[model samples]
Each structure stands twice: as structure tokens, then as C-alpha cells.
Target: MKNTICPKCGNETQELYDGRCKDCFFENFKLAELPLVLHAKICATCGARFNKNKWANTGSIEDIVFNTIEDALFIHDRAEDIEIYFEPRQLSPHMYRVKVEINASVMGMPLHQKLKTEVRITREACDACSRISGGYFEAIIQIRATNRQPSPEEIQKCMRITNEVLERMHKKGDRFAFISNSAEDKDGLDIYVGSTNASRHICKEIESYLGGSFSESPTLFGRKEGKDVYRNTFSMRLPEFSAGDIIELRDRVIEVRKFGKNVTGTDLLNGSRFLAPPDEVKGATLIAKRSTAANAVLVAIENNELMVLDPDTFETVTIKKPVLLSAKAGDEIAVVKTSHGLIALPEEVSRKNNL
Candidate 1:
């Protein structure tokens, strides 16, 4: 093999690769090749990179660019092994200088190659960010009470639910799930959402967590893609009465236990439980909170009623004893006075030294 001749260039060489001399082999075989300058599309708002004609949101810009270069490499068949390394240097906010080193083995010979190239990142807004910046929204949520203004605490709960839903949806790759705007008006609180599906999801969460019902109303806004586009407005009405509210209905004093499809409460007059729809509880008047009740002395007990002396007025009045309370005469207990009559409420008592 010391006297081999190459037929293509008539060159003499001891070693040959694919019938090519060492000089020819070196010229023909290439470990990898890339352009001097490459362009990358990037989102100005989200920092997303477009690679291989697709937008990727998973990695950093450097990782994305390195991967793109690795995929664009052309490896020759004669190269038995190939390794690539990148030394990236920032040239500007939108430009970078990447030093690429290619190490390979061809014909059992080691080879090293180096190239310095430029990566230009062109900034453009992504679809989600663009829509967000443009104030694009699909539905509006109106948080209101059935017959009165919503409390601040209720409004805060609604906002928290919306934020939580948006965060969960964003984690699942729905970037368009977000709240665009929020406003508090005299009537109620209004929240604008980016996606209709997200809007519906938020309403469901509100109902499930805060106890409410909502209705949807659609209005024709404009035309899109040669079709009429409509925007939805969800009117969510929360129950007027909340838990811990003492209400008077049908000559009965009841303490609201829970608010759901059916409003549940315990009858403060007789310790009986009652369940009614939200509409039926709407007519019930709020008398006082159980927390506002004062301690009264049980004067006497008779067949289904008891005499209690009001601690505030020091006036003796006969009220029905709640079946759940088993206090005897001369015992101190909590009692509330309502429009219909005075009622004994269930209280938690801890005796110390029989005081």
C-alpha cells in the first residue's frame, strides 16, 4: 500500500480512502457543515423560539439555538465518529456569536474543525401574547348577589378562584386562559376572560366553591372568518344569605347552616332542620348573627316552652326551647331576639369550678 496511485487526480499516496488519496480524502470528507450565519425567530413577549418551523416553549434560547445547529449539521458517511461543542458569547441583546467545534474520526484518523458563526434573533409577538396585549376576550363574568350588592369578601373569593383557574390552565399549556380585566361597579363585580372555555370553567368553580348559579347571555359583536362572532356574558348570582346568618322566615328563627342547591339551616326555635331552595330563602329577613347573641338566664321550663330573661333588657319573656339544648332552670345560656319572638340558640359551654 506504500505505492498506491489515485486515478482521479493521478496523485501517489500510501494510504487511500474510497480510492482517494489522503489530500483528496481530506478535501472530500466533512464531519459537519453549517452556514456562516443563521437566523432564529423569537417571541418578544414570551421568549419562545421557533425551530424547525415550529415554536418551542420548553427550553432557553441558548439550548434551542444549539439544538437547531445540531439538527442542521450534515455528517458524511466516511466520518466514523463526530462530536460537537458550542462556545456561545453574547454580542447584543438580539445577536450572539457561537463558536462551534467539530471533532471527528475518518479512516482511523482524528480530525478537528472549528467555525465561528452569528445567530440573529428576530423578535416577534406570539399569538397568545399578542391577543393579550390587544385586550382580546371571549366572555365577561358578572358577580352579583341575588337581591343585593355582593360583599367584598365574596368578591375577593371570586377573584381568587379566577386566578387559581388561570394558573392551572396555564400549566396545562392553555396560554390563552387568563383574566383580561376586572371592574367593580355599583351593581356587581365584572371580570373579563380571554377564553370562553376558561370563562365557563371559572363560573363553575365559583358555583362549586362559593355557592352560586350563573346564566349566560350572548351578544353579536362582529364577524370573524365570514361568520358572526358573539361574545358571552355570564351573570353569576350568589345567595343573599351566607353561613352564620340568623334569618327569620314563616315566624321561625333559623340559623343558616350551608348554602348550596338547597339552603340548609337549623331551626333556632325548636332545633329542627329545614331545607329550602335559594329562591325561598330570598324572602327570609336577616335578623342577627349568632355571634351577636348575649347570654341569658333560663328562668323556668314548661311543656315545649321556656321562660328566659333577656340580659340586655333584663325583661322576662317566654320562648320555645330548642330541642338540642338541655339546659335546666337557673342555667345561663345564649339567646337571640328576632322579629317574630325570642329564641334560644345552641351554645357551647365549658364549666370551670362550676362557675
Candidate 2:
């Protein structure tokens, strides 16, 4: 290396940084700089932080303070291999004092700097929170049954699905994913949602878990910024029959196991697997529930036929044995009486009764 003279310091050195020797160059060098005071906007309800003109989910208050300090910190242009650390202390619920340490190298020489700043939190309602509190909704989901009222259990499950979907959407950065209101009517449940997209997701989730279909329609609600604003209404129809329902369809008594996109069940008369589309059993009549079945006295097992005392008449009657029948002679078994005749319930139903 060749020696050179610094112009500003008039010193002989091996290198000159911006026409200055190392000693003269470092005299006014600053590794980092930070403002004395910083402000961070946080949502009071959800604890989200406002950053870069948008609301974002953040960590705890201390993490937010540390992030704010890091964002406002400025490092020297010549710095290399920079490392930064923050030590934050909460002065109060709305204020924090932070100490920042910066270590870097410039021109093969190590440098260190320490800075301090105060983070003052400003709490306010974010856009989502404000809209939710104001009862602003873009969609209404009406949960109804095809031919009956929605049971309390079904309604509760639907609401649970709606909330779960909205929560997932909100975590995925959809700020409008929120429920504004919900109500129960004689027919079913009515849910008001802030995001139409979230409403569609909720309806899809509900249909996937429970059996049914949904349709959507839009109506003009108002105008915004010279554009027509519309609100969506989703009509969700639940399946006509639910699990454990014993329905007589086309002369076959079926016990519904699941009713999703397709109806799945076991034929109560023969204990054979029965699967069909939702539209296939449209006119099925619900005779009774598996829970409502009566126990009959088993008289004898004659080959493929079972002789059991009628639950209603106490008269011995011969009926075809179900494929899943496990009861021996003289043991009580579950039997459901339909207009067709006495139908022996499956072994699973019998076990449920024992439980």
C-alpha cells in the first residue's frame, strides 16, 4: 500500500476516507442515529399496530416498541456487518423507553454506537374495529332447513363454524373478516358479516361439515365514491334429515349416519350400507329417531329370521334378522316399528343402548 496525505487533516496515512485521515474521519462519524421520540398507533380493541398506512397484527406492546425503534433507526452508509440490539423498559402502559445498541465495521475498523428513544403508544379503534362496533356489514347469511326448522344443536354448530372461518380469514390479513351481528328466528339463524368473501367461506365450511347447499344474491345498498355499493345475502339450506334420523325412503328404512354432499346411512331392515345423493331422497319421510327406538324381548333366532315380542303389542313376531345383529336368544334388542313391519335395529344401535 502507498502512503497518502489527508487533505483536511494534513496527516500522512495509508488511507484517506473522503479526503480525511482515520482519526479526523472518525471525529464526526456517527454509526447510527435515532429520533428522541417516536409514536406508534395501536388498535385499542384488537391490539393491532398501524404501520405504513395500514393496520397489521403485531406482538406484545414491548415488541411493538422495539419494532418502532428499529424502523426509525438510521445507520451510516459505509457501515458493514451491522448488528443491532434493543433493550426496552415499560415506563407506563402507554409509554416505553428503549436503548438501542449498534455494532458495525467501516474501512476494516470496528465501530459501536448507543442510542435511546421513547415510544409513546396512541390507542384508537382500527378500521375493522370501528366497522364492527358501528354494525357495518356487507353480507347476511340466512341459515334455514330444507323442510324443517334448524335444531339448536345445528344452529350452534353453524355459528361455531362461522366464527372459526372468520377468525382464520382475519389472521390471513383480511381486515374485514368479522361478525357484526347474529340473531335467531323461528326458522333458523341470521348472521351479519363484515366481509362478503368471509361470508362465502363460512357458508362453504358449514356445507362441508353439515349437509346442504347455499346460494347468494346481491342487492343495492348504497353508493360510495360515485360507485354503486351492494350487499350480499346468502341462503343456506340444511339437509332435511340429520344424523340418527330413521327415515322411510322408497320402502327402505334407513338410519342416517352422515348427510353431507351425499347421504350415508345403513339400511335398518337389512343392515346394508346405503349411500345416495342429497337429491335422491327428497321425499323421504322421517319415521323416528334411533334414540326413540323401543327395546323388544328376543324369543329365538331361527336361521336368518328373528322371533321377537312386539314392543307395542307384546306378541311374538317373525322378522328378518339384520346383517349386523349380534343379539342371541333371550337377550333384549333394539327394534323400531314402522308401517312396513317390525325392523330390528343394527348392533351399533344396540350397543348405544347398552352404553
Candidate 3:
């Protein structure tokens, strides 16, 4: 027996089970079950999520998983991992987005700078030829060749190198997106995506020339503001048709008490005090409806809408009228008019969901 900590639940494992014990191991394994369509940058040491900051020097992968602190890394381990990383990372549980950089080429060619892969070519760039020639030009070329936090001079050189490639390609009848690390000059060392039709041709040519680079991420370079990357915040929307989910079914309001007319909506808990559009709520499957005597089951909803239990049984009313409950089980449900439809939601997921 050995002791290991479940990184997420922070529970102690009594045996070595997939780096965790029996009860705690399931969470990690479950992550593998879920489609991995999301990629995120995290701290190599503390496992804290990374954004709003630049990172480099991630450690190499072992098979597909990277489990080393000395290495800054990301691991995509599944079928969906090929297209886009898939994992529900709650920027806020209800709202999520995935970010990743492309790896390898369409031909499946490997590019390793460390190994000096001949497939990875580095040509002396000449952007000056492009800028001076107006339309027909060769881009500039510069390099830091030294490692001291990639100086402004180094980045400048990288940008010039990028331009040179663009220039050479343009002359050769190519129009691709300009991707870069970052910039010294906000105006110059930036990214640019070409026209749709021409872009396809140019991108192909560039891919054929330079496969991949550790210093560059085309995805970041092609970052489309306000749309692809946004301060977007949204909640789940329940289905309105075919009824897989509905609102006001298991709607139980906790911590409600008599309050003055001036009491703000915040007085209600267990759910939103102020109602949002029906589309903004989570859905749950409608289970068997029954009736029972339960006091304090009524609550106010929307504008002047009262959710009250039937006086006789106080349970979810079965439309077309049928009774289903065992008296020995003390099973009693609240009966009320269903305004929203029902959606089948997983038990575990629904529990974790707040929306």
C-alpha cells in the first residue's frame, strides 16, 4: 500500500491506482472517457491554469502524457485530440472554451529543432526585397542566435524572418496568414490573415516550406478578436422541443422567508433570484411524478407566477391523470403545471452544474 493524493479532489489514496487509490482514481479515468477537445497551458510545478501570460520551454511528452515538473508541457491523449483538444474546462463551469496550437503537418512529417530535422529548414530571410519592391518583394532576415529571454532584438529578427517568408511566397503566388510570437513594434511585428481564396494556396505552400516551429503558433497569430477570443460569458440553454429537459420540475427554492415588498430578488437562493430567459437554464429529465402532503412547496417565479403544490397530494401533477407512488416508501411529489420541457441530464453532471 502507498499514499497518493488525488490532484483534483485532494483525497488520499490508499493504494497505487493510476497514481491514485480506488475511490479517487475514477475522476482522472473519467477525464479520459470524456472527449478531449480542449487544450490549456498550465504551470509545470503547481498545475495552475495559465493565461494572460506567455510561456515557453515545456518539457517533451512521454507517449502522450507529460508528468514532470521540470518540463512545461501539454498532452493530447485520445482520438478527438487530433482535431481539437476536448475537455470541458469551465472558464466558469457553465461556460467553456478550448485553445491549442497545431502540431505536425498534414503529411504527418515530424519537425524537431533540437534533433536538427532536415525536414525543418531555416533559410536566411530577405524581407527588404519585399518592402522596397512594393508588390514584388523579399522579406527581411534577422536572428538573436543567443538565449537571454529572447531579447527585443531577437523578436524583431524573428518578425523580419516571418516577413521574408511571406514576401518570397507572395512573389511565388502565395497568400497565407502571417503568424508570429509577439512583437516589439505593435504595428509591425503582428499577425495578418489573407483573403479566403488566396489564403488557402499560400498556407499550403508555407506548410510545405516550414512545417512547425517552437517559437511560433499560427493559432495565436490568427487570433480573431471579439469573435474567436472574447470576454464571452454564457449559460446553458435547455431544449424547448421534444422535451428532454424542462424548468420548474425539480424547482425547489431554499432559504425563503417572509420579506417586505421592497425586498430585492436576491432574497431567494438555490437558484436565480431574478429569472432569466428559459434558454439560460440547465435541463433535467422528467422522472416519475407523484403526489404527497408537503408544506412550504410554493414559490414565486417570473412575474406574478406562483409555483404551488396541489392541496391534496402536493406533487408534480401527472397530465392525463395517472397515479404512481408506493405508500410504504413515503413517496410524495409536488404537482405543478410544467411550463418548460425536460432534457435528460447526467446525474453527476447535473449536480455539478449551477446554470
**Per-model C-alpha lDDT, please?**
0.80, 0.90, 0.29
Output the TM-score of candidate 2: 0.89
Cα-lDDT of candidate 1: 0.80
Per-residue lDDT for 226 in model 1? 100
TM-score of 1: 0.70
> What tens digits encode model 1's per-residue C-alpha lDDT throughout 1-355?
3587987788888876778888887776567788888888888888777666655564688876786567666766777778888999888978888999988887789988887778887989877777888888889999999777887778888999899998888777676787888899877899988888888888998887667799999999999999999999999988878777788887778888767778877877667787888778768888777666778999999998889898888889888767778889999887777776677887533322110
**How well is each residue in 1-355 modelled by candidate 2, as lDDT tens digits?**
8899888878789977877898999999998999999999999999899999999988888888888987899998999999998888888988998888999999899998999999999999998899999999999999999889998989999998998999999989899999899999899999999999999999999988887999999999999999999999999999999888889998789999888888988987767889999889899999888777889999999999999999888999999898887899999998887878998887764323110
Off by over 4 Å in 1: 1-33, 50-59, 67-86, 100-116, 249-252, 272-283, 291-312, 318-335, 347-355
How many backbone overlaps does candidate 1 show?
0
The reply for model 2, stretches above 4 Å from the true place, is: 1-24, 349-355
The C-alpha stretches of model 3 lying farther than 4 A from their native spots are: 1-148, 176-190, 193-355
Number of the top-ranking candidate, with lDDT as the measure = 2
